[model samples]
Target: MIGDMHPGDILGEYHEEVIQLYGLGPRKVLVTEREAPYPDGRLIVSRTDTDGIITHVNRSFVEMSGYTEAELVGAPHSILRHPDMPRAAFKDLWETIEAGKIWQGYVKNLRKDGGFYWVKATVIPNVRNGEIVGYTSVRRKPDRRKVEECIPLYASMKAKEEEEVAQ
Candidate 1:
Protein backbone atom coordinates (compact mmCIF):
# COMPACT_ATOMS: atom_id res chain seq x y z
CA MET A 1 0.00 0.00 0.00
CA ILE A 2 1.13 3.53 -0.72
CA GLY A 3 1.44 5.89 2.23
CA ASP A 4 0.30 9.49 2.32
CA MET A 5 3.25 11.84 2.52
CA HIS A 6 3.82 15.54 1.87
CA PRO A 7 4.20 16.64 -1.76
CA GLY A 8 7.42 18.46 -0.98
CA ASP A 9 8.95 15.28 0.34
CA ILE A 10 8.15 13.51 -2.92
CA LEU A 11 8.52 16.24 -5.48
CA GLY A 12 11.74 17.73 -4.15
CA GLU A 13 13.77 19.15 -7.07
CA TYR A 14 11.31 17.86 -9.66
CA HIS A 15 8.64 20.27 -8.40
CA GLU A 16 9.81 23.15 -10.54
CA GLU A 17 10.08 21.03 -13.67
CA VAL A 18 6.69 19.49 -13.13
CA ILE A 19 5.12 22.92 -12.86
CA GLN A 20 6.80 24.13 -15.99
CA LEU A 21 5.90 21.03 -17.96
CA TYR A 22 2.31 20.77 -16.82
CA GLY A 23 1.44 24.43 -16.11
CA LEU A 24 3.49 26.58 -18.49
CA GLY A 25 2.13 24.84 -21.56
CA PRO A 26 -0.96 26.01 -23.38
CA ARG A 27 -4.26 25.03 -21.85
CA LYS A 28 -4.87 22.70 -24.76
CA VAL A 29 -1.71 21.14 -26.03
CA LEU A 30 -2.79 19.05 -28.96
CA VAL A 31 0.14 16.84 -29.64
CA THR A 32 -1.38 14.27 -31.95
CA GLU A 33 -4.69 12.79 -33.00
CA ARG A 34 -3.28 9.33 -32.63
CA GLU A 35 -4.61 7.15 -29.86
CA ALA A 36 -2.38 5.10 -27.58
CA PRO A 37 -2.32 1.38 -28.20
CA TYR A 38 -3.03 -1.11 -25.45
CA PRO A 39 -3.91 -4.76 -25.15
CA ASP A 40 -7.31 -6.02 -24.06
CA GLY A 41 -8.11 -7.76 -20.74
CA ARG A 42 -5.89 -5.27 -18.92
CA LEU A 43 -6.76 -2.97 -16.06
CA ILE A 44 -4.90 0.13 -14.94
CA VAL A 45 -4.85 0.80 -11.23
CA SER A 46 -3.39 3.53 -9.06
CA ARG A 47 -3.70 5.06 -5.61
CA THR A 48 -3.22 8.60 -4.46
CA ASP A 49 -3.14 10.40 -1.16
CA THR A 50 -5.68 12.94 0.07
CA ASP A 51 -3.80 15.59 -1.86
CA GLY A 52 -3.84 13.46 -5.02
CA ILE A 53 -0.21 12.45 -5.07
CA ILE A 54 0.46 8.97 -6.44
CA THR A 55 1.33 6.35 -3.87
CA HIS A 56 1.05 3.13 -5.84
CA VAL A 57 0.39 1.83 -9.32
CA ASN A 58 0.02 -1.56 -10.97
CA ARG A 59 2.17 -2.83 -13.84
CA SER A 60 -0.59 -2.20 -16.33
CA PHE A 61 -0.91 1.33 -15.10
CA VAL A 62 2.82 1.90 -15.48
CA GLU A 63 2.85 0.41 -18.96
CA MET A 64 -0.16 2.37 -20.10
CA SER A 65 1.09 5.64 -18.61
CA GLY A 66 4.55 5.26 -20.23
CA TYR A 67 6.14 6.20 -16.93
CA THR A 68 8.28 4.10 -14.64
CA GLU A 69 7.22 3.27 -11.12
CA ALA A 70 10.02 5.35 -9.66
CA GLU A 71 8.98 8.37 -11.72
CA LEU A 72 5.33 8.12 -10.77
CA VAL A 73 5.28 6.89 -7.18
CA GLY A 74 5.75 10.37 -5.72
CA ALA A 75 4.24 12.63 -8.33
CA PRO A 76 0.89 14.34 -8.32
CA HIS A 77 -1.69 12.30 -10.17
CA SER A 78 -2.27 15.40 -12.30
CA ILE A 79 0.94 14.62 -14.13
CA LEU A 80 -1.14 12.38 -16.33
CA ARG A 81 -3.68 15.08 -17.13
CA HIS A 82 -4.02 15.48 -20.87
CA PRO A 83 -4.46 18.97 -22.18
CA ASP A 84 -7.37 17.82 -24.33
CA MET A 85 -9.26 16.93 -21.17
CA PRO A 86 -11.76 19.57 -20.09
CA ARG A 87 -11.27 21.35 -16.81
CA ALA A 88 -14.96 20.95 -16.10
CA ALA A 89 -14.60 17.19 -16.18
CA PHE A 90 -11.95 17.34 -13.49
CA LYS A 91 -14.03 19.78 -11.51
CA ASP A 92 -16.89 17.31 -11.56
CA LEU A 93 -14.55 14.51 -10.52
CA TRP A 94 -13.22 16.37 -7.50
CA GLU A 95 -16.65 17.48 -6.45
CA THR A 96 -17.99 13.94 -6.61
CA ILE A 97 -15.12 12.23 -4.83
CA GLU A 98 -14.83 14.90 -2.17
CA ALA A 99 -18.48 14.28 -1.46
CA GLY A 100 -17.58 10.65 -0.77
CA LYS A 101 -19.14 9.39 -3.97
CA ILE A 102 -17.64 7.45 -6.85
CA TRP A 103 -16.99 9.41 -10.00
CA GLN A 104 -17.22 7.44 -13.20
CA GLY A 105 -16.24 9.16 -16.42
CA TYR A 106 -14.25 8.96 -19.61
CA VAL A 107 -10.79 10.42 -19.20
CA LYS A 108 -8.12 11.35 -21.71
CA ASN A 109 -4.61 11.08 -20.33
CA LEU A 110 -1.23 12.13 -21.70
CA ARG A 111 1.66 9.76 -22.09
CA LYS A 112 5.27 10.49 -21.31
CA ASP A 113 6.02 10.80 -24.99
CA GLY A 114 3.26 13.39 -25.39
CA GLY A 115 0.82 10.88 -26.83
CA PHE A 116 -2.71 10.39 -25.51
CA TYR A 117 -5.01 7.61 -24.38
CA TRP A 118 -8.64 7.36 -23.33
CA VAL A 119 -9.91 5.38 -20.39
CA LYS A 120 -13.22 4.64 -18.73
CA ALA A 121 -12.23 5.62 -15.23
CA THR A 122 -13.88 5.11 -11.86
CA VAL A 123 -12.38 6.96 -8.94
CA ILE A 124 -13.35 5.94 -5.44
CA PRO A 125 -12.61 7.48 -2.08
CA ASN A 126 -10.46 5.29 0.18
CA VAL A 127 -11.91 5.54 3.61
CA ARG A 128 -10.43 4.17 6.80
CA ASN A 129 -11.40 4.68 10.41
CA GLY A 130 -14.32 6.80 9.34
CA GLU A 131 -11.99 9.22 7.64
CA ILE A 132 -11.16 9.69 3.98
CA VAL A 133 -7.55 8.68 3.53
CA GLY A 134 -7.08 9.10 -0.18
CA TYR A 135 -8.37 7.71 -3.45
CA THR A 136 -8.05 4.64 -5.65
CA SER A 137 -8.67 4.89 -9.34
CA VAL A 138 -9.23 1.96 -11.67
CA ARG A 139 -9.28 2.45 -15.39
CA ARG A 140 -10.14 0.21 -18.30
CA LYS A 141 -10.28 0.52 -22.01
CA PRO A 142 -13.16 2.78 -22.92
CA ASP A 143 -15.58 1.60 -25.52
CA ARG A 144 -14.73 3.11 -28.87
CA ARG A 145 -18.27 4.24 -29.35
CA LYS A 146 -18.34 5.89 -25.93
CA VAL A 147 -15.05 7.59 -26.63
CA GLU A 148 -16.35 8.84 -29.92
CA GLU A 149 -19.41 10.25 -28.20
CA CYS A 150 -17.30 11.94 -25.52
CA ILE A 151 -14.98 13.61 -28.01
CA PRO A 152 -17.40 16.29 -29.07
CA LEU A 153 -18.75 16.75 -25.55
CA TYR A 154 -15.29 17.17 -24.13
CA ALA A 155 -14.37 19.55 -26.91
CA SER A 156 -17.37 21.69 -26.09
CA MET A 157 -16.50 21.69 -22.42
CA LYS A 158 -12.93 22.69 -23.20
CA ALA A 159 -14.19 25.54 -25.31
CA LYS A 160 -16.35 26.70 -22.45
CA GLU A 161 -13.43 26.55 -20.04
CA GLU A 162 -11.34 28.62 -22.42
CA GLU A 163 -14.13 31.12 -22.80
CA GLU A 164 -14.46 31.48 -19.04
CA VAL A 165 -10.72 31.83 -18.57
CA ALA A 166 -10.50 34.50 -21.25
CA GLN A 167 -13.28 36.60 -19.81
Candidate 2:
Protein backbone atom coordinates (compact mmCIF):
# COMPACT_ATOMS: atom_id res chain seq x y z
CA MET A 1 0.00 0.00 0.00
CA ILE A 2 1.24 3.50 -0.75
CA GLY A 3 0.37 4.68 2.75
CA ASP A 4 2.86 2.24 4.25
CA MET A 5 5.60 3.91 2.26
CA HIS A 6 7.77 6.61 3.72
CA PRO A 7 9.88 8.96 1.65
CA GLY A 8 12.98 7.08 2.79
CA ASP A 9 11.56 3.75 1.68
CA ILE A 10 11.87 4.59 -1.99
CA LEU A 11 14.39 2.57 -3.95
CA GLY A 12 17.18 4.01 -6.08
CA GLU A 13 16.76 7.58 -5.06
CA TYR A 14 18.81 9.62 -7.52
CA HIS A 15 19.42 13.16 -8.56
CA GLU A 16 18.54 14.13 -12.09
CA GLU A 17 21.27 16.17 -13.78
CA VAL A 18 18.87 17.56 -16.35
CA ILE A 19 16.76 19.09 -13.62
CA GLN A 20 19.83 20.57 -12.00
CA LEU A 21 21.21 21.74 -15.33
CA TYR A 22 17.98 23.46 -16.24
CA GLY A 23 17.21 24.70 -12.72
CA LEU A 24 13.70 23.24 -13.20
CA GLY A 25 14.19 19.99 -11.42
CA PRO A 26 12.61 18.20 -8.55
CA ARG A 27 14.17 15.34 -6.68
CA LYS A 28 12.92 12.03 -8.10
CA VAL A 29 12.13 8.80 -6.30
CA LEU A 30 12.32 5.68 -8.39
CA VAL A 31 10.17 2.81 -7.21
CA THR A 32 10.96 -0.75 -8.20
CA GLU A 33 8.79 -3.86 -8.06
CA ARG A 34 11.44 -5.49 -5.89
CA GLU A 35 11.26 -2.65 -3.41
CA ALA A 36 7.50 -2.99 -3.04
CA PRO A 37 5.21 -5.71 -4.33
CA TYR A 38 4.10 -3.84 -7.43
CA PRO A 39 2.08 -1.41 -5.31
CA ASP A 40 -0.82 -3.57 -4.07
CA GLY A 41 -3.09 -0.58 -4.04
CA ARG A 42 -5.46 -0.50 -6.98
CA LEU A 43 -3.97 1.63 -9.72
CA ILE A 44 -5.85 3.77 -12.18
CA VAL A 45 -4.09 5.40 -15.09
CA SER A 46 -5.90 7.84 -17.31
CA ARG A 47 -5.31 10.57 -19.86
CA THR A 48 -7.39 13.69 -19.95
CA ASP A 49 -7.42 16.75 -22.12
CA THR A 50 -7.12 20.30 -20.81
CA ASP A 51 -10.87 20.41 -20.36
CA GLY A 52 -10.78 17.26 -18.18
CA ILE A 53 -12.50 14.95 -20.60
CA ILE A 54 -11.59 11.32 -20.23
CA THR A 55 -9.56 9.97 -23.14
CA HIS A 56 -8.38 6.64 -21.82
CA VAL A 57 -8.37 4.36 -18.83
CA ASN A 58 -6.58 1.14 -18.05
CA ARG A 59 -8.37 -2.20 -17.67
CA SER A 60 -7.87 -2.24 -13.94
CA PHE A 61 -9.43 1.16 -13.75
CA VAL A 62 -12.50 -0.01 -15.56
CA GLU A 63 -12.84 -3.10 -13.43
CA MET A 64 -12.39 -1.26 -10.19
CA SER A 65 -14.98 1.33 -11.08
CA GLY A 66 -17.42 -1.40 -12.07
CA TYR A 67 -17.75 0.27 -15.42
CA THR A 68 -16.86 -1.35 -18.67
CA GLU A 69 -14.07 0.23 -20.70
CA ALA A 70 -16.50 1.18 -23.41
CA GLU A 71 -18.78 3.00 -20.95
CA LEU A 72 -15.93 4.97 -19.39
CA VAL A 73 -13.72 5.64 -22.37
CA GLY A 74 -15.67 8.66 -23.53
CA ALA A 75 -17.25 9.78 -20.27
CA PRO A 76 -15.85 12.61 -18.23
CA HIS A 77 -13.51 11.44 -15.51
CA SER A 78 -15.72 13.41 -13.19
CA ILE A 79 -18.30 10.66 -13.60
CA LEU A 80 -16.54 8.95 -10.75
CA ARG A 81 -16.14 12.01 -8.64
CA HIS A 82 -17.37 11.44 -5.12
CA PRO A 83 -19.57 14.05 -3.57
CA ASP A 84 -17.56 13.80 -0.37
CA MET A 85 -14.48 14.97 -2.17
CA PRO A 86 -13.88 18.66 -1.92
CA ARG A 87 -14.30 20.68 -5.08
CA ALA A 88 -11.54 22.97 -3.87
CA ALA A 89 -9.14 20.09 -3.79
CA PHE A 90 -9.88 19.24 -7.41
CA LYS A 91 -9.63 22.92 -8.27
CA ASP A 92 -6.23 23.03 -6.65
CA LEU A 93 -5.27 19.86 -8.48
CA TRP A 94 -6.18 21.32 -11.84
CA GLU A 95 -4.39 24.54 -11.14
CA THR A 96 -1.25 22.72 -10.08
CA ILE A 97 -1.23 20.33 -13.03
CA GLU A 98 -2.12 23.06 -15.51
CA ALA A 99 1.10 24.75 -14.45
CA GLY A 100 3.00 21.68 -15.66
CA LYS A 101 3.89 20.61 -12.14
CA ILE A 102 3.04 17.49 -10.17
CA TRP A 103 0.59 17.27 -7.30
CA GLN A 104 0.80 14.58 -4.64
CA GLY A 105 -2.04 14.12 -2.22
CA TYR A 106 -4.61 11.74 -0.77
CA VAL A 107 -8.01 11.36 -2.36
CA LYS A 108 -11.25 9.63 -1.41
CA ASN A 109 -13.05 8.12 -4.37
CA LEU A 110 -16.48 6.57 -4.56
CA ARG A 111 -16.92 3.18 -6.10
CA LYS A 112 -19.88 2.01 -8.13
CA ASP A 113 -21.57 0.62 -5.03
CA GLY A 114 -21.09 3.97 -3.28
CA GLY A 115 -18.40 2.54 -1.05
CA PHE A 116 -15.48 4.87 -0.49
CA TYR A 117 -11.79 4.10 -0.79
CA TRP A 118 -8.70 6.12 -0.12
CA VAL A 119 -5.70 6.55 -2.33
CA LYS A 120 -2.44 8.41 -2.26
CA ALA A 121 -2.23 9.99 -5.66
CA THR A 122 0.53 11.61 -7.62
CA VAL A 123 -0.71 13.61 -10.57
CA ILE A 124 1.65 14.81 -13.24
CA PRO A 125 1.18 16.90 -16.31
CA ASN A 126 1.88 15.12 -19.55
CA VAL A 127 3.94 17.60 -21.46
CA ARG A 128 5.20 17.39 -25.02
CA ASN A 129 7.94 19.71 -26.16
CA GLY A 130 7.20 22.06 -23.27
CA GLU A 131 3.53 22.13 -24.11
CA ILE A 132 0.93 20.92 -21.65
CA VAL A 133 -0.66 18.13 -23.66
CA GLY A 134 -2.70 16.48 -20.95
CA TYR A 135 -2.45 14.87 -17.52
CA THR A 136 -1.77 11.43 -16.05
CA SER A 137 -2.23 10.20 -12.50
CA VAL A 138 -1.08 7.23 -10.49
CA ARG A 139 -2.98 6.31 -7.34
CA ARG A 140 -2.39 3.72 -4.63
CA LYS A 141 -4.07 2.85 -1.37
CA PRO A 142 -3.29 5.40 1.28
CA ASP A 143 -2.37 4.76 4.89
CA ARG A 144 -5.30 4.59 7.27
CA ARG A 145 -3.95 7.30 9.53
CA LYS A 146 -3.35 9.65 6.65
CA VAL A 147 -6.84 9.03 5.33
CA GLU A 148 -8.27 9.75 8.76
CA GLU A 149 -6.46 13.04 8.88
CA CYS A 150 -7.60 13.99 5.39
CA ILE A 151 -11.29 13.22 5.79
CA PRO A 152 -12.19 16.21 7.90
CA LEU A 153 -10.12 18.51 5.79
CA TYR A 154 -11.79 17.29 2.65
CA ALA A 155 -15.24 17.51 4.22
CA SER A 156 -14.65 21.07 5.36
CA MET A 157 -13.22 22.08 2.04
CA LYS A 158 -16.10 20.45 0.21
CA ALA A 159 -18.64 22.21 2.34
CA LYS A 160 -16.99 25.57 1.80
CA GLU A 161 -16.64 25.12 -1.93
CA GLU A 162 -20.19 23.87 -2.27
CA GLU A 163 -21.47 26.83 -0.35
CA GLU A 164 -19.54 29.19 -2.51
CA VAL A 165 -20.71 27.56 -5.68
CA ALA A 166 -24.30 27.59 -4.52
CA GLN A 167 -24.10 31.32 -4.10
Best by TM-score: 1
How high is the lDDT of residue 4 in model 1? 27
Instruction: Give one digit per residue, the lDDT tens place, for model 2 in 4-103.
Output: 1133533344221110101222323222222122237468787877666678888767766655777676665665565566766777888899888999
Worst 10 residues of 1 by lDDT: 11-20
Question: Model 2 segments beyond 4 Å from truth?
Answer: 1-42, 162-167
Model 1 stretches astray by more than 4 angstroms: 1-30
Each prediction's whole-model lDDT (CA): 0.76, 0.62
Q: Write the per-residue lDDT of candidate 1 for residues 1-167, one digit (tens) a residue.
A: 22222333331122111112223242222244456875699989999998888999999989887778998998878877776678778878988998999999999886665567889999999999988999999999889999999999999988897798689
- Candidate 1: residue 135 lDDT (0-100): 100
Clashes of each: 0, 1
Q: After TM-score superposition, what is the CA distance of residue 135 in candidate 1 from its true location, in Å? A: 0.3
